[model samples]
Target: MHLQFITAACLLASASAHSTFQQLWINGVDAGSSCARKPASNSPVTSISSPDLACNAGAAASAGVCQVKPGDDVTVEMHQQPGDRACRNEAIGGNHYGPVLVYMAAVSDAKSAVGSNADWFKVAHMGLVSNNPDYFGSRVLNDNCGHFTFKVPAGLAPGNYLIRAEVIALHVASGSGGAQFYPACFQVNVGGTGTVKPPTVKIPGVYKASDPGILINIYQDLTTYVLPGPTAYGQASPVPATTAWPTTATWNTALQPSTVPTVVPAAGATGIGKA
Candidate 1:
């Protein structure tokens, strides 16, 4: 029948051109059934030793939690396979780019949200947002379309917290295991009194598979780029570095489209995880 609908739309556009990291947001709601994601598709967890790196290891686990204060604005929604959310933007076809991270850990309640021992750090970061030298990494894939906003770092120190968002493709990293990490985790509950602890790295020892930004090579000789961890803690307010670049970004259009739904919070919970 007409080449089977063009072979099922080229296998759903090659599985939305390889995608991962499902959902996580604060100012926009939806914490993916209450953190500990792995809900489905949006793949990529190619053994950084696989504890699902701490969250996905739960693989769809949920006790639900998502609340915020102390400078909210989390947001991080990417998909392209597990029920497809129309994802795909590796700069059009130059393969996936790299750099884009966030981490935090401090849950000893709510059954310890993030498993695998849990002990993450680093707070907010964005490599090549304009680091000159022809800004590599496809400028966050034609200016970040997969959505990844940052915040929640205003001296944070409330209570339950487990936020982790990552995107390190490295375009095959040239070697040493061909870089491709797509982490995801979200379970917040900070109402805030502000103290700011900050300082705790332990995601496979803060990444070190030859750690030169996770083994370089973004197509060819990259001039300069170094954005591994630490030094990205809620700098005042700078969340909008490319709302959703298509023909060159600038499409805010009233924003709010990460498939918003889950805001669950209430099951022996402490409060603030929103309903």
Candidate 2:
């Protein structure tokens, strides 16, 4: 009985391992093709289609095509060469520009998996003035099945710019969410025009009313007062002869006159004199 139980356990473990390995194979096949294979150079340029095989050696896959189970994470990395300059539009007065590339990676299991949906990808060139008549552009699939290249036209103005890649997943199974690659940005430098010097600013030495140094002069001028009358009037009324201003007792007593009467009355009552 114990031997039978052990055999059953081993069988279950083997089944689980087989299931897991199968899922891994699916994910690996999809991502491997997407990253390893390149589209045909002579393939006609067309709008992105469902189950996009443009990058998968012309496979019949459409957009939102997934090989693994539901609910898995997909990773993508897009790259661009610094100076490819292969795409040019001389007829339209546009300058040649380099290509941008994108790649994909995925994680999957028997119950969960993810893959790329290249059909839903789009690119936009930003930082250039809109409404310009001269702009050349074209799209090319990169060597990797997961990446695509966008070329800029010739005669583009020299400036900083970003090439944004927009991707959307369409056929995610229930309970599984789709992933989108972040927009890619690239800096572009156009031919240089003649160098021009920047203008210099010069401030005169004139004293400004708002200057802090002028405040001191204004305060001193306000504190200096000139009397309109003679010295007697110019001086304040001797501080009102107040004892509060005098610290010495003698000075305080001298400021006040003697309070005693100058004359003495008769000792006894008299008609003309009073006691």
Candidate 3:
């Protein structure tokens, strides 16, 4: 009966382990925007300006619909409005022959209600599955924006890549347990080659929640990763064998006889005697 009860409990717990995540895209001018910004010239080849320009050049063309060249530097900017927010970043140009710079920003609550803590609004890169990296979260000043700049590795192969931003919303519970969180993702494109302008790709307005590849990746991580040892509270350990109590004879054999005697005495008698 005890074993049956345990089996039933385990089955019920397994049935209840179906928590899921739903990601929605924040809409505005920036929802489907590119990082590529308008350059001083539409020319393909140009001199390197500054490090920031190197990163901004590709990102601006990718997100902002600007034509970029190999050595041209571009600047990408994210503007926050009252109703919605925008994310702008860069990618490698299609014809870009030399190295390029990519600038990115991860912004949260650009228009919505973000919790009191500032760290929740930052963005970081999410690598491919089986290679998740530790993401560093930073704070963005209120009414101001957050920015990040990185040089596109020199001589990178031309291909499609996503410059993404993650937005988090905090929901406070009535009791003292903790706050809940909702996370959203946004992406843009980068294009152009050293001397050739790459064809443009249509950016998706919203994120697909039902992507099977993404689901499989997240599922594998939650199940396969194991800790070094059993949990401190023994929750993950196997149950130990139970032992029965000792018999009366066994208890008696383990004890020694006492030296004192049991006796009864008359109240008036000077000496007591056993009755």
Clash number by candidate, in order: 3, 15, 31
Name model 3 segments beyond 4 Å from true.
Answer: 1-64, 67-144, 159-161, 169-275
Candidate closer to the true structure by lDDT (higher is better), 1 or 3: 1
lDDT (0 to 1) per candidate: 0.58, 0.20, 0.21
Mark the regions of model 1 whose C-alpha exceeds 4 Å error after superposition: 1-17, 23-65, 68-80, 83-156, 159-162, 167-171, 175-189, 192-194, 197-213, 216-227, 231-261, 267-275
Name the best candidate (by lDDT): 1
TM-score of 2: 0.19
Best by TM-score: 1
Check candidate 1 and list the clashing pairs.
20-42, 34-64, 245-249
Q: Please provide, for model 1 over 48-130, each residue's C-alpha lDDT reduced to its tens digit, 9 standing for 90 to 100.
A: 66667655544555566666777777666555454334434342233456666778787766335544567777666666454
Write one digit per residue (lDDT tens) for candidate 2, span 1-275.
87576456434422221100000012112122221122222121112222222232232221222222221222222222211112221110111111222222211221122123211112122111111221111112111212232223223323322222322211110112211111221111223332322121111111122323211211111212211111121123111121222211211112211121112212232211100
* Cα-based lDDT at residue 27, candidate 1: 60
2 or 3, greater by lDDT: 3
For model 1, the local distance difference test gives 0.58
